[model samples]
Structure formats: structure tokens, C-alpha cells
Target: MDKKFAGKKLLVLGSNVGATDIVQYARDNGAYTIVADYYPADRSPAKRIADEQLLVSTADKDALEAFIRERHIDGILAGISEFNLLIAEELSARIGLPFYFTRKQWDMIEKKSDFRALCEKHGVPCPKTYVTGKEIPEDVMQQIRYPVMIKPVDASSSKGVFKCENEDDLRRYYPESLKESECGEIIVEQFVTGDEFTAHYTIANGKVTLASVDNRYPIAMQEGDPTTIPIARIYPCIYLDAYIEQVDAQMRALCAGIGLQNAILFVQGLYDEKTNTFNVFEAGLRSAGEAPYRFIKRVNGINAMHVLVDHALLGKTDFDSDKEDPYMKGKCCGIVSFVTKGGVVGSIEGLEEATAALPDVIEYECRYPVGSETPCGRTLRQLMIRFVMICDNREKMAEDIAYLNSHITILNDRGEDMVFKMKPERIWGIQ
Candidate 1:
């Protein structure tokens, strides 16, 4: 058999869930893969799957360079996290490897303020936003409308984002919110009320070759939580055709304006039915979290994990253009995140039985161990478990989810138990 990437060695940074998938995909494509992570061998799942594991902090330049030198790595891939992204760019530059984004481009995308400014310069339809500090600037404050959204400029996953209704709310939350962020700068923007959605695409040689869009339904969230975890995502979004076209145009323009060349692009936006407009929110130069992976695979019959690896190694994708998955046509796939209220998981019922019954159920992952305490949102240990499922029939999808919800149980510290439930607003709409 002729190997597509026989001689290439791919070094994947971060051993989180996303990284492990990427590593496995690369290995399946005949590439020698090395998983480098800061955690110990036992804690790293990618380490178990890769050809070799290297215990090195990608944040440390010297340590990262030494590992690259010792291993003779030819390419690099980064997971969805921000820290891993910065390190990936640095290593790519230092080792002369094929990287998706340049150091400057990565920095621009990482910082919320920089990304907003780039969007403005390029005429992308982003929310009207302003930066704030000790005393809010008169002009900047005046520009923002009531019910504004305030967040840290450099935070990811929706950390420190709050909807401030007036000056009092802003004054009350401003100080602590700024202090809590890694970067002290904060962004205040006009909060648009509309249906939220996300777009995912892959750029190669500065052009978008593949793309998909999904409707976002936020599930669990508290005061300090980054954006609410998504409960379900419906693909081929139920939007006017013109609105989808507008979104696609905005994404293409933003990528071209920022000089974004290669890698996956995850863009979030809101669709205002009243005005028939799509407002651009945030764009990350990485794959959507594992939530959407199953949906994309089901709809397109393409493994995005393999696509990312192939692009990293050969600068081209191996998508079978003629082949398509009929299950996705005019059908919706939903992913429900099984969130425990608090504390360690005592027992999870019906997971194996559910999977056995519903083969379309892609994966059910327990992020924490049986006895480990699951941390609340805002901490690094937010995710407890995720139950991902898919089906061609929307009614059957709802039935499976309802059945799963009734079966799974999570107990807290006081012996009180709670089952995962989807907020009604998340399923239908806030209105």
C-alpha cells in the first residue's frame, strides 16, 4: 500500500480530548505521530494513542525547541485551546514546519480586541464594540447601547462575558471582571438579540475549501461560566437562504482581510430575523470543539479529524467529492451534553445500553473519574461528561435524549442526586 504521509512526522500539542482525536487521525493516515503535553503519561490519553509521548511544556520555548530537535518533527497541529495555539505557532516558526497560522495571525485571533479591530477595518458585520478601563471612555461608552455585553479581551470559551443592562450593572461588574481575566483589558459591545449560529470551515493556501453551519442552543451556564455549554446543534440551519449567503460572504471577507491562510475556522454569529441580518461574533482558527465533529461526519461522510491531519501533512484534503451521506439530507443531528449538577459521579446508568440500542450515538465521554469532584464552570475542570448522539429523524432524536435524561443520575456531595435536563429556552427559544 502506498502511504500518503509515510515519511512525515506530525507533532500534536495538548493531549486534551481534541488533541487525542487529531493524533489518532494522523496515525490512521500513516503519519508518525508524537503527542506532547504538560501532563504526566497516565493523565494523557493522546500519549497512549500516539507512536510516542513527550513530556514537554509547549509554553516553554527552550523545552519545546529541544523536543522538536530531538524528534525531527515535520509538522504541527494545535487543539482548540488558546495556550496550545500560541505554542503551536512558536514551534512551527522555530522548527520551520508547516503551520496553519503565523505567529502574528495567531496573536490577532487570540486577542478579542485585535480580532474586533481587524473585522472593523475589513468591513465585516461585527457587533458595535468598545474597550473599557478604570473610567469608561465617554465616546466608547456612549457608542454602546443598553443591554451591552462585557467580556475580557483575551479570554476564550466565553469567560467573563456578561450582559450588562445599564451603567449600574456595568459599574458593579467591571472591576472584578477585569481582575479575574488573564488579560486585564475588557470589551463592551452592543448585545444583539437574535438566534445564534456557528460556521466551520477549513482554509488551504488562503482559500476556503470546505464549510458547514449549525444552529447553537446554549444549555448550562452560571454567572462566571464561559459561554453556556451547547446542548444540541442542528445542521443545515433553518434560516433564509439569503442570510446563509451573507454569513458565508462575511466569513470569506474576514479571512481574506486578516490574511488567514490555512487551518480550520470556527465563526459564531447571530441572526436577527427582524432586520434579516447576521452579526459576526467570534472567529477561532481551529476546529469546533468535539461536539460538532459527529454531526459533520454524519452529514458529509468526511472525518474532519482526518481532514485536519491530511492538511497539516500534505497541504491538501482527501474529501471524496462524489460521495455524500444521505442520512444528512434534510435531517438534523443533535448533541446533548450530560452535565451533572455537582460533585463526583457515583453512577451513570443506561450509557452502554443506550449506545447498543442507538448505534448513531457517536460517543459518551465521562470527563471526570467516579470519585473525582467535578468543578463548577469558570474553573479549568468545568466539563463533567458529554453524551453525543445523532439520528436522521428529529423525533427519534428527542425520544432518545428524553430516555437518556431519565436514566442517567448524578449525585452531589450531600447525597442529593440530580439528572441532566435541557433548559426549555435552549431547545426552543428565549422568546
Candidate 2:
């Protein structure tokens, strides 16, 4: 058998769930993979599959550079890790290794203020934003209206994000958002109401080669919940076709303006049905989190993970990029994440049943092993389990999800069924 990445040394940063999948994908392509993470060897599942495991912080650029140098690594790869992306950019630049995004380019997109400015300069549709440093001036605060969103300028995964309903709420949450920022900067933007959608694009040689869109929604958020915790996503966004052409044009223009090349980006936007317009709010110069890699492979018969490795590591672009490509035609797919209450988790039931009974179950995963204590599992960051479901149509999806809701259950040590206190609005539905 011919190994495409034979003898290539690929250094993968951060051994979280996303990094673990990337490591396995690289190894399958014949690359000698090394998993580096802050977590211990026993706790990190990605480490177990790697050819070598190093318990080191990905944020520490010097240590990572030394490890890469000592190993004579040929390439570096990172996904679903915002902090590590910066480290990868710095290390790749220092060692004279080719990288997807330049340090300057990464900085522009990494900071919320810079990204908003770039969007404005390129005529990209985005929410009006006010970038604050240390404090929001009285004059600046006066212009802002109620129901705005305050977010850390350089944070991801909603670390320091809050929705302020009034000036009082802003005063209380402004400092909280600032704390999550390394530079003590935050962006307050007008909160838009619409269905959220994320676009995935693969750029090679300064041109977007592959593109797809998905609808994203927060799960487990209760009524009046201020924080946005996205625990579910549906592929082939039901509303994508309504404005696909316009959004595609905007994405291409944004990439051209940023000079982005040889990378995968997740562009987040809101779709206003009333106006029939898509408003892009933010974008990341990295792969979108979730099981998109597997979804693309199963639906399109294309292994996008392999293409990601080839592009980010080998500077190659030998992959499909047709916009009209047939992937899971006449099918609807979605995923739901299970969040448990904080306590000692005994065991979960109905996973086997879910796979067997669901019309087209694709994958199922559990984070905590039996007898493990779930730490704040009710929080988005501590999701206990997740499973994917595919259906021939939207009706089947709704029916299967209904079945899952009634059948699946998580329990605690005292034999009490853990009920997910999801907000009524967040109940599963096809977006």
C-alpha cells in the first residue's frame, strides 16, 4: 500500500476531542502523529492513539517549538483550538515552516475588533460593533442601546459572552467580559434576532475550493438564559438555499480581502427571514468544531479530514470542491448533545437502543466512563454525551428525536434519572 504521508512527522496541538479525531485521521494517511496537550496521558484519549504523547501546554510556544525541533517535525496541525492556532502561527513562523495564516493575518481575524473592521472594509455584512478598551467611555456608552451583546475580543466558545438587556446589565457584565480577554478588550455589538448559520469553507492557494453551510442552535438553555451554548447543529441548513449564492459571494470576497489561503474557516452569521439577508457576525481561521469531518465523509463520500491534513501540512489541494456536489441528497442530518447535572454519574442507558432504533444513526459518544464524577455537566463545556442522527427526511428526524427524548436517560449514584433542564425553546427541532 502506498502511504501518502509516509515518513512525514505531523505535530498536532491540543489533545481535546477535536484534536483526537485529527490525530487519528493523520495516522490513517500514514503520518507519524505526535499528540501534545496539557492534560495527562491517562486522561487524554488522543494521546493513547498517537505514536508519541507529550504532556505539555500548547499555549507555551517555546516548549512546543523545542519539542517540534527535537522531533524534527515536518508539519504542524491544529483544529477547534483558538489559543493553539496562535501558538501554531508563532512557532511555524519562528521555525520557517509554511503555515496557512500569517501571524499578521491571524491577528486580524483573531481579535473581534479587527475582524469587524476587516468586514466593514470589504463590504461584508456584519453587526455594528463598538470595541472597548479597559472601560466603556460615557460618550461611547451613550450611543449604545439596550439588548446588546458584550463579548471578549479574543475569546472563543462563549467564554466571556453576555447579553445585556439594559445599561445596568452592561455595567455589571462589562467587567466580566473584560476578564476573559488577555488584552482587557471587549466588543459590544447590537444583538440581532434570527436563525444562526455557520458556513464552512476550504481555501487553497487563495481560492475557496469547498463550501458547506449548517444551522446551529443552543441547547439546554432555559427561558431567560443569557449565555448561548450551542449543543446542536443541522447540516444542509434548511435555509441555505434561500441565500446560498449571496452568502457564497460574500465569503469569497471576505477571503480575497483578508488574503486568506490554504486554510479552513468557519464563518458565523444570522439569517433574517423577514429581510431575506444573511448577516455575518464572526469567523474563525480554523476548522469548525463538531463531527463535520465524519458528516462530510459519510454523506459526500469525501474524506475532508484527509484534505485538511494535506492542505495544512503538505500544502496540497487535491480534493473535491464542487459547490453543487451531491452529498446526502434527499437526507437530513443533525446531532444532539446531552448535558447532565453535576454529580457522580453512575451509567447511561439507551445508547445501543438509539443506534438500533433510530432510522439512520451515524455515531454516538460518551465523555464520562462509568463511575466517573461529572463536573458541572449542566454547563456547555462539560457535555456528558452526544450522538448523531441522520434521516431520509425532516419528518423522520423529528420522529426519531422524539423517540430519543422519551427513551434515553442518564442516572446518578442514587439511581435518580438525570433530567436535562433545557429551556422550552431549545427543545430539539430541525432548523
Candidate 3:
């Protein structure tokens, strides 16, 4: 069938690789594209692909509204940022353009505490959670089981998320860590241990359409390190078909309870092997970064970027029914994010040779520039590059990952010094 977006103008908020793909897809499908970002120095791959580039703060409501009004933007799509998601929803409402989520729905998903409460009200199984801005009461502490997860109520990419082993860890991390979040409220919940996975979907006319399910194999053995981001995300998750069905039902109920309309949803949860239960951790009203998109596209042969753009431009209501199940032969495709250990990134070596060696490699992009000082911490800042790979054979997947790890290197301050090696098992345990 011919593309649906024939003459729409799309405004992409944020200029990352995901935004680049969206902008490029819009342009390729006969739509005008505008790439906007808050930081002027923030160079985006999309800027090179967009028809026009605008430096406007998404947080600045007036500037955003004026841009939409002056340019007659048909729709607004957010890159994988919570801050930008708010701007996208607001701009869509102000300009009378189709939006992924309404203002109320967006607010519900953005605030962690509120989202947990909503899930509880709807009878969805989420971790036992609470919020605190001060000292944890003795009674509250008694109620909360040990080894709980502590995190800021309104943060993403696992920023400030800590695993508190006991009361001491809680005291050490709270109040101080609370300041890091834009929202002061901190969330304390029971730490659910199991195989963690993410389900990505789109809601249209109150129906939940499953786009893809990603099994997140963390780069780090533990959470909260930037360098420890997902080393590999296998799409069409194996051994979770029944679990996915349960998750889909719960997600639909949660969206309906919050009055969510058209929008993209990224719901994260842990599947416990002991009890065979799926416990939700958190949810976002946006895409799951560029990594998941790569796998989704490879397996299904459907571009998630294009689907998002089409939703924004032509209204999600017009999506074709035949394209509903976008999985590819139940094969697994994965993405591994390359990260820095510490020190300035002097150079990236062996990428071309690595890809040439493994044709299963889909795409790889570096986020940092040469000579930029790499920040310390296990969190997202450590991420320097991203590599996507696709394979139907499970053994070949292992081979592909090993090939990339052996070839990639991150140089430190010393001219001849190479930083820590990227070990998939050390970062994210074998899945």
C-alpha cells in the first residue's frame, strides 16, 4: 500500500538518533520535518536529515507554541526523554494536532508515585511502593521489606535509582539523592528480582496494540550505572508469550483507568521464575530509546520510527490492521550500547572492521565526540556508542556480541591507555 503520510508536517522534539530516524522517515514519506532541541551544542544525527532545524526549549511553553503556530506543524513526536514528552503533549494540545498522549495521561505516566497508585487502584500487580521526602518512619520501615529499590519519583533512564540493602542504605541515599530528581518525592519499593523485560506499544481508540517486547540484558551486573545500560535487548522475547499476554491486559486496563487515548507506551516489569508472576516496575509514554527500535525494525521489517511518524501525522486511528503483529518469524534481534569506562574519548577504533566481520550487525552510532571528557559514574553518562545486531540463530547472537566486544576500545586520558574493557557478562549477566 502507498504511504499514509503524503503531505504532513512533523515537528520532532529532541535531536537524538531516534528523532533522526523519525525525521528521515517523514521526509522519505513525503512529509516535511523539523528538528528542535533545547541545547544549541547538542548535535543530532536528525539535524542532518531534517528539512529545518530549530533551537527551542521544550520546557519553554511560549516558544514551543509560537513555533507550532508559525510553522503550522501537523503533529509533534517526542524523542526518548520524559522532559520532551511533556512538551510534545502540550504543543499538540495547543496546536490542535494529533498527540500520542493527552496532558492528563502524560502526567499520570511521568510521575512514578502517581503511576503506582493508579496501578494499585486498577488491581494491577506492581511492587509495594511508597514515597518519602524526610526520614523513614519506624512503622513505614517495618512495613517495607529489606533490600528495597529506592528511586526519584519523576526520573528516567534509572537516574538516582538505588538498591537499599537495609535501613542504612536508605538513610545514606535518600534526601541527598532526592535532590537529583526534578521532583523532590522519592519512591521506595520492594525489589522484585527476576528476568526484567520491557513491552512497547501504541494505544488508539482505547485499544492496546503491541508493537514489540524487549528483554533487557543490562550491561552492568547491577543497575544505576550509565555504562551499565542494556548491553543487548532481544526482541519478541522468548519464553514470555503467556507473560506478555498478562502484561498487555494489565497495560490496557491501566491506560483506560488513566483515560489514555492515542500514544506510545513503554512498560517495564520483572518476570519472576519462582512464582511465575509479572510485576510492573514503571512505565513511560514514549519510545524505549533507539536500541529497541533497531531490533523491532529488524525482526518485523516495520520501522517503529515510521509508525510513530505516521501516528503523529495521519492520526493513529488510520493505521492498517494487517500491520498489527510486527514480529519477524519469532526470531531474536538485539542491540548493545557501547559505553566508556572513564577519561576523554580520544578515538573509536575497529567499528568498521567489526561490522564487516559480522553482517548481522545492523547499525552503530557514537554519542560522544572525540576529545570530550567522559564523566565518571555507572549511570547513562558512560554511554559513548550504540551497536545494533540481528540474528535468527541463538548461537550466532552470542558470536556477534563477542565479536563487537573484542574489537571496540575506549581510549582514556593517556595517549596509549585504553579504558576498561566492555564485557557483556560483567555488565549485564548472560540472558
Candidate 4:
């Protein structure tokens, strides 16, 4: 394992599941790993595996730089959080390390409103939107169609998003949505109904490659739940070819226009199959926590994480990636999510044996172990586990999923079934 990063020190932000993977991956490649967050070392997963733990807050750049110089930190990587990504971008600039997007480029599309503007500027398709100030004008309100989505400009994870059925709903949810934003702004857009998907891209020296497209098919949660959460993320979206033909080039143009030379970006898209139209709504500039790198490695022999690490440490990376197939080269893949009605986790059983026994299961994570307390009204927080797999087809995937559901069991304090499993139709796309 002694490799290219042997003498380097890499500091990673946050201690969530994604940061844990970054820390271990860095250390495995011989880089000394440090995890920095305000959490106690015992409570932080990534810090537990790191060579050093920093209690300094990620926001305190001055304190972080002092330690960075003291430890001779050579590189920095942000976890899945967008706030941390901005911090990582700034730190890399100050430390003279390789970071993909400059602050100027990043700021142009950080907010939903601004991203929509970017799409319009580049001729990329996006939902119809209205950029408003503190108050929506009568003219704007009259022009807006019914059933619009109001979202905080700065929030993620579906927080502060509302689907307004009418003017009354907009007035009701706008202030609530505004409360969730750090910058005190919100954007309203038409709530387009269609199949939802996410496109993954890797960029190297201005060359953008469509790494993968997955069906982030939104599911119906409880009644009046404003959040549109994806049931699963299965590879090769139904409109993959149409997306490449219609939207991929414009997305690349948007990337190039922003001067992004080396980076990984994920775009949230909506497709109208009847009309063959595709549009983007949101995007993130870091490795998605779902860990697409698992199937990306299995399908294309490319490790996007490794490429990012190399760029961070060496100031340059050669992406020897096969970009020909964003469809996983005819392989079916997924990141299966298991959720539950909110409660305290009593015990989780047989996940280890199930994963080892299940065919084509590349990785699994029990995010919340036994005795963990989660909120009652939580959305994504209700996620109990995630499994990444690559199978031959939908039939094989169904078999693997059946095996997992039968083997793994999660219980609440009352000894009742707490886990919610997705049906085969939800796990794999119907089209």
C-alpha cells in the first residue's frame, strides 16, 4: 500500500460516512490522514480512523491554517456537504494545492436561482423559474403557474423546499422556506412532473466525461410531505441516450464556461419521456455520498476518488477513464436505500452476513447502529442503511434485493419491524 502519497498529509473536512471513506482511502494510499470537525473524536467516524484528529471547526480557517502549516498538510478534500466544499475550495487556494473549481466559478451557480440563470445563459434546459427579492410582486405572482416549488437558495437535502398548490400555499411556505436559508433568500420554480434522474460527470483539463446516469426516481412520502426523496439510485437512467443527445453537451458547455478543468459534478435532472425533453434543476461539486465510485470502478476500471486524490496531492491527475458508456457498459447497478418510520433503533441484525452472502454487493453501510436515537419527523435521517451493488440485470438485482430483505432485520424498542423496503418497481425503473 506504500504508494504515491507516502510522504503527503491530507486533511479532510467533516466526519460523516463520505468523509470516513475519504480518510480511509487517503491512508490506504500512504497519505497521512487528518479529520477536522468540532465533534469529539469518539463520536466522529472519520476522525476515529484518521492518523490525527483536529477539534478546530471547519469554519475557522485561520486556526486550521496554523495547524496545516504546523503539520505540513499537503492537500485538502471536502466531504459531501456543500458548505464544506466551499471551505475546501478556499483552503486549497490559500495552501496552493489543486482544487477543481475556483471560488468565482463556484459562486456563479451555488444557489438554485443562480443555477437556473446559468442554465439559461448556456442554453441548457431547466424548469421555468422566477427570481424574486424579499417579496413576490403582484405581477410575478400573477405570471407564476400553479403548483410551483419554493426552495431555499442555500439549503440542501430537500430542506426548506415546498410545493405550493396555490397562492395561499406559497404565502404559507415562503416564510418557512426563507427561515431555512442562511443567506435569507428563496427561489420559486414550476413543479415539473416527470421521471427524475441524476447525471455524474468527471472533468479533466476541460474535457468533461459523463461518468454515469442514475434514476433518482422521486417517491411519494407521507401525505403533505414537502420533500421529494428518491426511493433508490439505480444506474443507467431510462433516458440515458436521450440525455446524452439533448442535454449532455449543454451541461458540458456550462462546465467549460465556468472554467472548471478538473472536478466531479452531479446534476439533478427531470425527463419528460413523452416529449423526449430533459432539464436540470440542481447540482453538487463533490463526490456524492451515495458512493457511485463503487460501480464506476467495477464497470469502467476507473476510481474517481483516486483521481481526485491524485489531483489534490500531485497538482495534476491523468484520468485514465473509459467514458464511452455512462450506462455502466450494459451492467445494472444500484445504491439501495432502506428507511424506517422514525424511532430509536433497538437492534439491526444479519447485515454483515447478508452482504457477504448477497451476490454483486460491493459495499454496505449501516448508518445508524443499535441504540441510536433519530427524530420522529425526519426524512433522509430515517435512512437506516445503503447497499451498493452491480448485477447482470433487473432480474438478478431483484433476486439480490430479496435475499437482503429476508436476511436483514431492524427492530424498534417494541420489537416491531421498523425497516421499510422498496418494491421491485421502486428499486428498478419501470420503463
Candidate 5:
């Protein structure tokens, strides 16, 4: 409508919740948006916002490239999902679109073991990692100390990730990790017991800049079939002032060492209390999974989505025009997503009242309609609803969260209320 990208056609690879926002951004910014994914049009929220939807598999590189050429598309973008990165790389090469990563760089970051090795090669602090093939060797097995994390080398959102306390646990979970990866590879990393955090970085002209950091809250079900899943992200993190300098230094080294100096990177690491250092566990050359674009903008008054679109579309390197600081100064914000044990929802209650009563609540999003069946899983896909809250201080943030827990209720088909709790101690990384 504005003609910012009036004649431009932007192709997005996926049509999930995150991609929906990307599609809308393009449309709102005056670009003709096209979304390509195998998901049926009716089920794709992004397809509703896009000008066109190509019901082709994003993995079908040849077909997608042909579509791009035939349609005269101008640029390409993909969100947090890793599976679509290869497709983006392929289409970018075939059509000369602006992709943030080269295939080599993409491979290095997408494969967990490769990134760990890169960390070691560059002297970046990282958890001790051991790569395993189809069979775990006795020698390698002998070296693994207790309490290691077993996960796929090429998966996202902690899918197929397990914390093994002993050799027996490793043997039982190794195959499960392998199944989650397209590549038959898995890694056993010595678990660093500490607070977990994720830092966002932007690279331009070979210089790395820190965007923001958030305290990641990972939730786990301890009673039945224990499993860990990330549930919330709190911003204006408590450790920002204490650790920003060192974390920035380490990220600069990582970006320079990996030869990645023209895109955004989401770095996940742990603040190891034992070593008193931050050790990276994973890095991705893309956005993080938890709708960070919205969070960053809300808390810091910076539009990450605009910067990303401009960077990917026009290759514009300067992003400081909209930067603001002191960023999130004297403020606190949190994103809390809801989930169920997996069942057909009979009814939902208190959403409207709770949201209206909380003055600090800024945004509310629900993924499911009433009566829809919700899946039972530990992945982000199971997230049913999300609430964005902000306050003058952390005390108020905690108070708002507690109110929601006691007020909001989700009843399954059997009319049983699903218990929702936000235990601070269970939060993955909060030192």
C-alpha cells in the first residue's frame, strides 16, 4: 500500500506462527508477499496474510527455484526453523537473492557437533561435546562422565534432547536423538549446571554487535515421563550489566572465527557457576524460536523485523538508525506461552478477564480455537497461547505471572482443569 516494496516480491519459506508475522511485515511495508510450504492453505496462518501461497514443499529446491524464476521474485527469507535454511540457500544461489548465510556457514551452525568444534577451534568457551555415530564406541563411552545432554546434531527447539545421568540412560536415549536428525548423528555434551541465557547478535561489515539478551525459562514435567520444554523468556535480564562485556567479546570472536559477518545469530549458552564463565551450547544464524522479534521491539523500542527485512531484501548494512539505548533501561518484560497435556479442549476461561485486569499486559495471542484438539508434546508446536507482559520492575512481572496462573484455566474434553504453574526454581537459566 505504501510502495516501499511496491514492485518487489518477497518469498517466505514457511507459513507457521513466526512466518505469519514476517509475511505481514512484507505486506505492511509494501512488498507483494508469497509463502511456500507443504502445509494446506487453510491451516497456514501465514498464507492468509500472503498475496499468494505456493503449495509446494519448501524442500523441493528445483520446483521452488523454478517458481521463483517464473514469478520474478526479488528476495527470500526464512524464520527460526532450521529445515528451511537449506532451501533458502538453494533458492538464493539459483536466483541471486539476498540470503544471510552461505551453505558452508549454514552447515556449520546447523550441525551441533560442527559448531562445538568451531568453538573449540576458536577458544570460545563451550560445553565438552562428544559426537556419536550409529553405534556408541566403548572407548568413547568410557570417557563420558555422568550427566550429559544427548541431542540431535541437526534439530531445533530441544527436540530429541535428553539429559542422561548414566551410561544406561545414554544407551537408551542415543537412538532417540538419532531419530530426530536428518543426519544420523548425535552429541553427548557434559551438562553445565547453571542459569541458561540466549543472546541475540547482529553482524555487519565484519563487525559484531550485541542486540539483546533474555533469561530463558525452560519448563519440565517431572511427574509423568519427565521432559523439558522452553515455556517463557524474560527480558532486561538480571545479568545483562554483569555479563554483557564478556559475552560480547566472545560473540565477536565467534563471528570472526566462523567467517559469519553479514547476518543475525541467536546464541544460547549457560552461565556456569562452577567455572564463573559463559559457555555456549548452541548457535543459529537465524532468529530464535520464541517470537523474539516482537519481544525485542516491545522492550527496547527497536524494530528487528524491519532491520531484517531491509537487510535481506536490499542488503542494506547500516541498522543503527532505529537503535535505542539505554535499551530496556529500568524495565522488565516477559513472554509466557501456555500448553496442555494433549486433548480436545472443551472450554477455556479467564483469558479476557485476566488480560483486561492486568495493566501491564501488552499483547495476547491464542493459537487454538475453542473445541480444537491440542497436541501433547514438549516442542514449541504444542504452545497453545501466549501472553506478553511488561512492568516497571521484576517484582510486578512476577506478580502478574502469578495472577495469571491462578486465574486462567483450560479444561480438556473431560472437563478436567489443566494445572498451570510457573515455578521460578524450575526456570532453566537464572543465576
Candidate 6:
């Protein structure tokens, strides 16, 4: 087999969920991969898969940069972590490497306040946000409606975010939100009660394309939890055509205004079915941690890992960028993430059986093994195992998911079924 990247050495920062795939993708293409983080090899799975493991913290900029120089790293890829993107862009610029975004471009989209401003500038619909970096004014507070969201301007994985049902709720969560941010900033925005949706986009040679959109079905959240991240996401976002007609052009304008080129991003938002509106809350500037790229590749044959690797290896893009099928090309795809309650995983079951039985399950991974402690699996942090599949329709997806759900279980020391709290059958149209 010919090795396209035989001579190249790629540096992947942060052992995020997506980093494993990025490392594997690069290594498969004949490049040496380095996984950098401060975690033990057991904690960060990507470290075990890489050609080399650098036990240096990605946040230690000085030491990390020195290692890059010493290793003669050819490229650095920060696929999904919000904090790691800043580090990647900085180190890439300092070392005269090819980065998708400059400091200005990174600032424009990474921060919630700035991205909201950019959306408003280009006529894209985002939540109506109040002041950032501090609490809302007393006078403004009186005029505001109930049910708002307070979150840090620069944080990911839904950390330090709160869904405030009233003024008291906002006041209580404001300081906590601020504490989560490295920049000591917070944004209070209107909280929409509707189905959450995520629209994925890929930019190439200055042209933007809406690759796919999916509806995020949230796990039933416990009280005091931040807005629930999804337990499962089904593609062909029933509102796909509506999105193209209403918000796609404005989004393209927003990306063009910021001069973003050659990258993948997904806008996280809620769609009000009653009002027929799509409102955004977050914009991730790389492959989503949910691993939407897996579905995109399985459905349409465009590998996002390949696209990102091409960009990181210095401006060379070998794949076609203009092709996109946001409607999923007449196919149905689903990503089911099994989440458990807070505790040490005393046992795990049916993993091997499900993988063997379910032919449609393209990929699945469980990060928290037996005996591993998971702190509040409500957030994306504690996702036990994620299964991605593509099939013909929602009915088939429902059957497969129901079967898989019945098979897999993550129990704590209490001998309870941890992941059965919100069965996928609820939204997937199965009894």
C-alpha cells in the first residue's frame, strides 16, 4: 500500500473523544501520530493508539511549543476541544504552520458573545443575549422574561451553564458560570423551549456547505443540571428544507464575514416547531465531539477526518469540498449515546453482543469501563458508549435502537440500570 503521508508527523492536542479518530486517520494515511495530554494512558484512550505519547499538558504552552520544536512536528490538529483550539491556532501561527483560522478569526467565533454578534451582523438568528462578563442590570432584569440561559462565553461540554427559569435562577448561577470561564465572562440569553438541533457545515476554498443537520433528543435531566445534552441524534433534521430556505444563506454570510476557510463547524441550536424558527446558541469550530463525521462519511463518502488532516498538513486539500447532501441523500442515520447517573461503574454488559448482532451499527465505543468513576453522566463528559448507524428510515432505526438499548447496561454499585432512565423508544416512535 502506498503511504500518502509517510514522511509527515502530526501533533494532535487534547485527548478528546474525536482525537482518537484523528490519530487513527493520520496513522492509517502513513503519518506518525502524537497524542498530547496530561492524563494517564488509561484515562485518555487516544494516547494508547498514537505512534508516540507526549505526557505534556496542552495548556502548558511554553513546554508544549518546545516539544513541538524538538520533535519537528509537521502539523497540529485540535479537532473538538474549545480550549485546545486556541492553543492550536496560537502554536500554529508561532511555528509558521498552516491553520484554518487566524487569531482574529478564532476570536470571532470561539466566544459565545462574539459569535452571537457575528450572527446578528449577518442576519442569522441566534438567541437574544443580554450583557456579557457580568450579571444583567437590575433595571434590565425587571423588563426581561422568565426562562433564560446563563453560560460562560468560552466554555464547552456544557460546563458551567444553567437554565434559569427566573431572575433568582440567573442570579444564583451567574457567579458559577463566570467561574467556569478562563476569561471570567458570562452571557445571559433567552432560553428556547423546543427541540434542539445541530447543523453541520464544512468550508473549503472559501465556499461554505451545509453538510447535514440532526435533531438532538436530550436525556431527561436532573434538577440543577445545565441544559441536557442529547442522548441520541437523528439525521435529516425534519426541518432540513426549512433550514436551507431560511437560515443557510445567512450562515454562509456569517462565515464569509469572518473569513473562515477550509474547516468544519456545527451550529448548536433549538428549533421552535410552533414558530418554525431555528435559533443558535453554540458554534463549534471543528469536527463535533458527537462524531457526526462518521455518519457523513457512511452516508456520502466524504471523510471529515481526511478533510481536517489535509488542512493541518499545510493547506493541501485532496477531497472535493463543494459536494454536500444535507438531506442525507435519502438515508436515515442515528447516534445513540448511553448515559448513566453519577457513580463508579461497577459493571458493564452486552457490549460485545450488540456489536456482533447489529450490522447497521457502523461504530461504537465505551470510554468508561468497569470500575471507572463517572461524575454526573448528565453532561457529555460521562457518555458511556456511543453507537452510530445509518439505515433506510426512522422505523428501522427505532427497532435497532430498541434492541441495542435492551442489550447494553451500565450499573453502579447499587445494582440499578444506569442508562435506562430515558429510553430512545420515547422519540424514535417505538412502544
Please provide TM-scores, in order, for all candidate models, with all chains considered together. 0.85, 0.86, 0.84, 0.90, 0.86, 0.87
Show where candidate 1 strays beyond 4 Å.
Answer: 121-123, 130-135, 139-144, 157-159, 171-173, 180-184, 220-228, 240-242, 316-327, 376-383, 411-415, 423-431
**For model 1, what is the C-alpha lDDT against the true structure?**
0.68
Candidate 6 residue pairs in backbone clash: none
Q: On residues 1-431, what C-alpha lDDT tens digit does candidate 3 reach at each position? A: 56666667888888754776777778877888888876563456777778888887767778878888987789888677767767787778877887766777766887788888878877668898755543467788777778888888877756678888888898898876687678677888888887778877766656666777767776653364333565557665664576656667767777777765555677888887678788887888778664476665556555545656766887755444245553546565666666566678777778778888887877776667778887666666666676777777656676677777788666665765444434544322434
Per TM-score, the best of the predicted structures is: 4
**Per-residue lDDT for 344 in model 6?**
82
Evaluate model 4: give its TM-score: 0.90
What is candidate 6's lDDT per residue for 1-431, written digit by digit as tens?
77888889999998885788889889888999998889888988788999988888899999988988998988988767877878988999999888877877776777899999988888898889777765567887787787888889988757788888888888888888999998888988887866778888888877888888887777555766545666788888877888888899999888877777688777887778789888887787776767787878777888766777878885866667655788778888878887767788888888899878988898887878888887774567756788888878777777888788787777887787766433645554311
Please give the clash total of every predicted structure, in order: 1, 0, 12, 0, 2, 0
User: Runs in model 3 with CA error above 4 Å?
Assistant: 1-7, 38-42, 55-60, 130-142, 157-160, 165-174, 177-183, 221-228, 321-327, 368-372, 408-431
For candidate 6, the per-residue lDDT at 49 reads: 92
Candidate 2 similarity to native, TM-score? 0.86
Worst window of 10 by summed lDDT in candidate 4: 422-431
lDDT of 5 by residue, 177-238 (tens): 88998888888888877677888777765667677788877666455545556577888666
Residue 308, candidate 2: alpha-carbon lDDT? 58
Better of 1 and 6 by lDDT: 6
lDDT of each: 0.68, 0.74, 0.70, 0.79, 0.75, 0.80
| Candidate 6 off by > 4 Å | 1-6, 28-30, 38-49, 133-143, 157-176, 221-227, 344-346, 374-377, 409-414, 421-424, 428-431
Give the alpha carbon lDDT tens digit for every residue of 1-431 in model 1. Answer: 96788888998888765787787777776889888877887888888888988877777778878877887877888667767877777777877776667867766776777888877776667898766443478676666668888887777755567889888898787875686567578888888877777777656556654356667666545655545655556555667374546656665777777776556677778888789887877777777674466566666766555656766788766655343332356665665666655666666566667667777677777776667777655332454666676666666666776776666566664666633465433444422
Give candidates' CA RMSD values in order. Answer: 3.6, 3.3, 3.8, 2.7, 3.4, 3.2
Error of 1 at 297 (Å): 2.8
The TM-score between candidate 3 and the true structure equals 0.84
Instruction: List, residue by residue over 266-297, the lDDT tens digit for candidate 4.
Output: 88877887787887888877666676877887
Pairs of residues at least 3 apart in sequence or in different chains that clash in candidate 4: none
Which is the leading candidate under lDDT? 6
What does the lDDT come to for candidate 4? 0.79
